[model samples]
Target: MRNAWSRAMVRGAWLLASILGSSAGFCEQMNLREFGQPDGLGNLALNALQQDAQGFLWAGTENGLYRHDGQRIERVATQELRRVAALASGGGHLWILSDTGTWWWHDGRLERVLPRTAKLPQDVPMAIAARGDEAWFVTVGGLQHVVVDRQTDSWSSSPVMTAEQLARHPEMGRLASVMLARDGALWAGCGDAICRWHRGELKRWDARSGVARQQWHALLEASDGSVWARSTQATLQLSAGAEGFVDRTAPSDRGDPMHRYPLVEDAAHRILTASQLGVLRWQGQQWQSFGKRQGLPGDGRVHALLSDREGGLWLGLRGTGLLQWRGYGRWESWTDADGLPSSVVWTMQRDGEGRGALHVGTGRGLAAFDAAQGVFRQVPLPHAGDLFGLVPDGQGGLWAATDVATFHHVRDGRGLPGPITTPGGTEDGFLWALASKDGALWVITAGKLHRWPEAGRGPVQAVPGPPGNAQEHFYDACETPDGTLWLAGARGLARRRAGQWLSSLAVEDGVTYVACGEDGTVVAASEAGQAWRVRTPGAAKPSLESLDAPVLKGRMIVSLLIDSRGWLWLGTDAGLVVHDGTHWKLLDRSQGLAWNDTSGHALYEDGDRSMWIGTSRGLSRLIDPSQVFATALPRPVLMSATR
Candidate 1:
């Protein structure tokens, strides 16, 4: 069964990709969040940033060095080592260069490279690069190399290029930036040229070698094994076996030749940098700009940039503090401040036919999104109350349920007088959930379950639920493609097949949500975050298996959805967790979610496959969720172990 599910997921992912296409407008925009003194960084003028082996981010500022572990920032070094210049991490140690001198941090202890009694040259260090037990520093005077004796906690320093070598190649002096490439070669940006040191041979490139003579201030080895050099004048790239570098500067940067932008390569091997205009990404042999028009916060100049292991882009603004861009998808949010009826969104459904407007149910009332104006307009309903359980009718209308009543044929901001009635034609109380499949609508009111036939041609039939507590309330329900109906609520899970209700499947905690997969499988989740998968849902002897995901162990799951791509999305009290068969990833406020606590029955997939999450603060739309599945997973290798 697991193999069959995996095959379905791969097929669905490919189909989804082809359907989405490669339109320019389909690309995700940059989603950025800024952090400042409020987020625990004492200083805003960041000088350098690096990610260590353990995945912690190190930020250097004028005051001190701080460490960030995705949540909070704490000062790790004293204030005496002021004006940190550069940082590099490798071999389980972080090398630091500051105005005072050079230092290395290991196992929470910081030690100066040289004691105050034996100080080295007083020239300011421009950049630092590390590999294994060796670190290199580029300074105004020359390039310095340091080797560490880890066992003895001692180190030795020497000049990489001696004065004789500098005299032979005059253009290699005045080094500014350095990078240790994956090929074990040391690349440096000299004042008037770029140099590569491999083994004992040192090669230089200057105007004579068809390269620009501007001072290169930054160097990076991209994922494609190409070396990129950045200067205030232009940016250049050197391909694997290329003799010289090619000027790949953006056309816009050619006009302003003095803008110094920080450069970093993202997890996707795309070159990323930022100017006063906004963030720029190198794609299709050109620079694509994402500026204030694309929802970037504060127009301050970006000073330091680093791409973390999780694919997030970090920008250290000159004075605006730190900012992180969520790399998966662009998030467009709306709240009361953005013309939403209320900040507390309960449910959402797409209205009309193809690519229709989204109708949302908020704490105050209902509102429809006007994509053209990029704002939500209040759609007044007959009963002014909080709404939930919104599902689309077969026609260009909707079926919505509030606490006191349920309405059908809800169109153009007005609903018809249609409510769920009992067998005696009396109104039911407190409608809780609604589901539609094969033109048949399933309604759960308080504790009673009813089936409303297609187009309301026949009378509503009150169905008998699985035997359990008389007052057991139903919270959610879904119907598989095989005409199997699954219901989840306080008591647990129940299924109905061929008009016959089966016995109740009791879980540890009462199941609160249920979702149907395209392969006739049903996934049910309890409030305690325990989830179970039922295969062959239409069969009399269906098999049940528990989903083992440590990330969802103690989370309070409020909503569950199995998207067309076979990805399971869980809306929980902490955040939104998605499992793509082999891996689980969390998308919270840190990743551009409006809020961590998602609302019940608030997870919806639009006609375009985008996800809409309704939170207490507002609503967020995750554009192009298929991007997360773009990268292929590595195949596993098995090994036999002997006891």
Candidate 2:
């Protein structure tokens, strides 16, 4: 008993370490929607982006101004205002700045403002900032300001500071970018310094004031009213009432100079920026990058970014057009379009060599996951058949089973010649499941159980199945830690204990799947979605207890898994369901799965504790199960009792 207790403690410690260690570097799943010429944008080089109050996205490209109404993009005809450089929206208007001139769109009217005849800077507009009816433009010549007369439907422009005023305040001249804070303060990026203009007062922070000595290129105000300044070398932020700007640049930014792009804050108050590496989100006092592995399409260099009203981020790439990111979540999927061999995944298992690669068996053939590239590469199989079962051989090799035979020692995309022939020459039958226990392989096929030794010295031996009068069509099998073999099929649930078949639990519908937990707990389910749990599995007198899983009723449960945390996961026809001891949760298409119908024996848990579910349309992964199940516990309530 003491030894058992010690083993339990060791298992608990390992489970805890796995959960904590995996989460430290876990990447949240991202859903991305790409928009390009196929969607009506004339040019893919998006230079500026903005979303209006009505939820319409305005994109400024190198050729013309385009508007996306959540469905399609159409160019807003501008007579000669081409080569759009920047865009801003304020006061029920979207302001467009081009090399030709500046224009504003309001209620379907495009009016050109601050033309060359207006005596504005001839150096070209680099950035624009707007608030209410007023707009500010930063040009190499200086800063320009424009105000609209709503009553008269007109506009006027003037230099923010005259030549004499510039001579007095040289630190605010040669402006590059500008931004208007929530508190009505105007911030601008000067040549080598950042300046703020608030209520007729000017404040400047330069190298002398501890600011990084680089060309300040962009400025932004976060939701919390903190001003962020982006320079050629670093990114700095200045809080309200702070003495000076604090450098918040990531360590990786020191080597890459492309991190000087614009910064935008999401609705959650987290700051995000685009770079050559990918989208970087500022959280926990550091930057977390999301690139192709996180589902960002294209080269990851975003020319412009906008956080929309729906909490979605719009990324404007250089030549790849527009992409809408739904932000990080627990679910992500990959389909055949993402380089998978087939969408119909049958089973998946981790590489026994401990390389962290997942080998997937699909209807077409076998494929291996490429974690670095975020895609799947097909692993050529010697035999041309749909693989239904895949398991690690516990000797740095893999075992795959098809309808006719089972191949062992599959490595480096090659399978050995020797195949354990199916028992009874059942060429017409299908191999349902395979399990490895005590260095031996257990196979279930056509209602019969067979045990094949690892040495491969003799022919396969048939084992006694559970006692049942009905035709037994076995579908799944699992071995408990106590050397008991549990089988599920048309005959219901059965177990082989101490070399003898035990009594089987007969359900109204035949059981199709079974899973064994480390604590000697056994769970079995039927196609009709009825589930039963055995707390004292492998015991002399084991009894089945019905689980109160109403959500699973009427659903086709294709796969079941008892994860290290003791949570029950069910891959069903509708979605992926989980019972975290008490409450039940479902994740489907709305929650980021590619498809609703899951494949049989396609549920897997990797060394990192992340759950992988295979569906008819694609493969889906749940990054961190603990985050989904870490719901707040119910609080105790006091009740008044009547005497």
Candidate 3:
């Protein structure tokens, strides 16, 4: 606080708003500069969202195919199965299988045509399943097939298998269902028998061996991906390797009447057995019946059920509001009482962690959840959470720079361990927060760019920058993992690399911060939010906004931070956003961000996936995630980035 250099830092922070007063002010007048989805891909009905191994969301909607990377949704416009029926993925790319052929979303690019032909099986994929290197899908033609050779990646009109092979297994001729078991084997639930195809061979097992008088109804493979099936008279569990079946519904295992439509398996030990009379959960040893006796949708016949991200089960009663199980013997109804979209939830998607949210986007804007408690709430921002720059802190935390402020949080629901403070207070601000090579926290406050040894084990320290004229004046500062500092203010942008303050980026190869990878490039953005390196400042990279004034009017880019995943998060005046290597994604209210636009003021990471986004209004954290929903599938709604 006694440093003369720190005094200069406080006086130089006003240069940004003053510069914005020109172009940004003009756009603000016209109200043309909005931050979110101002144009394209209007509220696309995102029915299916899955995350591939690479962490990108492959969305299959009622309309077309989109690739969402948590910030922006990319339309596979060319020939990506419009009105896409079923979506399944494996080996890194998304398989957009329609009624005719497959469109491969592979290698960060879309191949409009994988292969489709009328001469081959009818392509309307009912349900697609996959194992390690292989995948199997059932077409409306009643046939189960695999992705035989993606390396060679060739196919033909003729059957992938021989006619003799098909003749030998007439039971598998009409494929009804399929599932990829936990052990990486593909299970084909045909009308007669369920065959296992994996490791270059196909094997068959029929239901007659278990349910003598019944046929297979449904199949569910859980997180472990173990395969389980239910028939009219029995519930069978597939052997780990899928060599045979274990029928649990014998007279000993409870010879209950078999369920007709829904058969959900929990890992492999339990099965949700639904019958016209009632519903029961069959663990390895017992059948726990739940119905009017247990407050499960007053009706004895439970038709449909949806579980939220919070482990609360929801039952879709034939004639009642959606029901929720609060705790032991406690039921909360979401009829007209709460903000439920409808009493009749034909289908629901429990997302964000099964702890919150049940997206039922029917006729309204989009109704589901508003995360309440927990340090890391998965609620939507009022409108924007688009991502921009990220610096993954390796310890399960990330640093995000939004259009608003810096943001950092763990993806899981766990809250921060303690109070987050920079080396100093808010006076050295506007853009004065960053991390150091040894995980030190550097911030500009009062009269100096303060440096706090991030762990607190060391003494609180201060790093002084250029002085300014007024007490209200201050500068912006960001640190890198390598001890470099990037600071900006009324004067200009400056960085410290080799123990010296370089007035420009060129001294450090035009990098804002010390980066450990090829992605360490600093962007000097101003003038309609146009960006280039500070060195160039006018070369084109990608447009954060196409319109100039709309952003100035309402939504301004408030913060920017980076995550370990190499993506950029932007906290904008409108909301929050993220930028993957390729696209711009707006992460605001609709996608479960905080209600306030000031959510990310000072961001930091914990070296893991944990991110802490500090807003002027409140503090928010995204804890380390427990469950990762799949975007490589055609299911319903958001992922790392919500729709």
Candidate 4:
């Protein structure tokens, strides 16, 4: 037991060191900066990566395509190009082969290589090979050649292999990969053998030629006339010979670190390969390994590798996002000490004066975040409390909901001492939510609702609860432009206008959130992921339109905010969704979001129009949402000048 305890202690110490060793210099060696939902990567499951001639890195994920310009990352919006299977560069353009079809990205945008009017013989393209004016797409059914007609500036595609040719080469079953060899030969990896096309002649090699008669997943040609093919269990090196190509597999004694993935040649001419265990590099004669001991994340199960022009190695881990090896031996990571005080952020409110600042309600206390300074300043509350809600007090002060009581705090971090108390003065149930309308403060507590007039003379009055079971709980509340109070509750949604409470829309499950849009569009979301976009109340029949955004249809929208530009931002269980009038775009953990559990009423759009989201893990601010959209969002005139 003592020995086991000692071993556990050692492991714990090592983990602590990995997390807290700021001066360890591992950042310089790995130089790894991982990005996901917070940094705007569309998906964590990266399928392919390529660097364009202009030094822009293109990452093809399962959900979207991303471009990195060494400083910022942005998603490239390409229609029907979600599941990228392979990427190739040729003819001064980058060719992207997705599950749907093939696209060419040039001049900062993606355009389909084939015309929309022309349909390919097959729909799913598995691999792409491009050289000079020729490009081949190996689809699920057969091989296709994309032809460019410069005369009409039109594009067309046709099958490369005829029915009789396919019948002759029976071994070309479900082509997996293709590459252009240095000897001007077109090599393809198929299920049963490697097919080579030279001088208009097709040749196949099977196990009789020392090559395994199994699926070859990838094929690459080295500068030294050697061809590398990844088989089901090992990597084989092939060389041209008199009778087909002669091949040899890597040494098996080292546990086969290739992981059935392709071998990538780095700038130094070393072959880099990845497996389920670690990453190995063949330096001509010997193998060098890198894994967790060398600061690689996860089980070292990398799926994609790239050697950039800047002499850095990039590893795309299976589920850990992207990591770069700068070979500098140092690493630095941000933490709560940097600015944020608590990981459990419950609510966020923008400053009323549009000062490019926001106040965050955290599990610890209240914190202020300045967008210009790019830092968080913790505002120590007078008493120890867990803050759940925050709102502008209309007098440069702020109102906060806490476990003990609700207090109005000044802007300079001093909490004024007029504690709003319940009739019983019991501290058992804490206040959970806060909203203000028409000089009246609306507060939701654990047990009931309280309304206090801003005149500072009347006692806190209890508003009649929603007409339902006595135990119905409330989640959020908002006010419309016409002075109507909207409440989200367990039974449904309620609105109180002109001192009369009216039960509005009711759902079987419950309405958990409500946000008032700029155009009097009342967007209310239920616990069951159902959303209704209704116009202003008191009309003969307000049109109730169901939201059809695919990302928000079946997910709980924990947070909702309608920005000034009329874009509806929703924080759901799966990720973040921004609906720009016509389409919805999702940003999730794959995009670098710190946490998916966003707090209700925690979405804030600051003066600079950047969105700050409060989540259970911490606070994340999207510096610019327009960057996600390839086309810029329209801005209102005179508003920019006023700011």
lDDT of each: 0.68, 0.68, 0.41, 0.60
Residue-wise lDDT of candidate 2 within 105-201, one digit each (tens)? Answer: 8988888887665333322223788888998887556678889999999999888887887887786776767878777777877767788888767
Which pairs clash (backbone N, Cα, C closer than 3 Å) in model 1?
none
- Cα miss at 364, model 4 (Å)? 1.2
lDDT of 4 by residue, 482-594 (tens): 77777777777777787776656766787767778666667877645677777546573454577886676677666676788878887766667888888888875434454
TM-score of 2: 0.63
Worst 10 residues of 4 by lDDT: 6-15
Q: Which regions of candidate 2 fall more than 4 Å away from where they truly are?
A: 1-165, 168-176, 179-329, 353-356, 369-376, 424-428, 468-471, 630-643
TM-score of each: 0.63, 0.63, 0.37, 0.49
Q: What's the distance in Å from true for residue 52, model 2?
A: 12
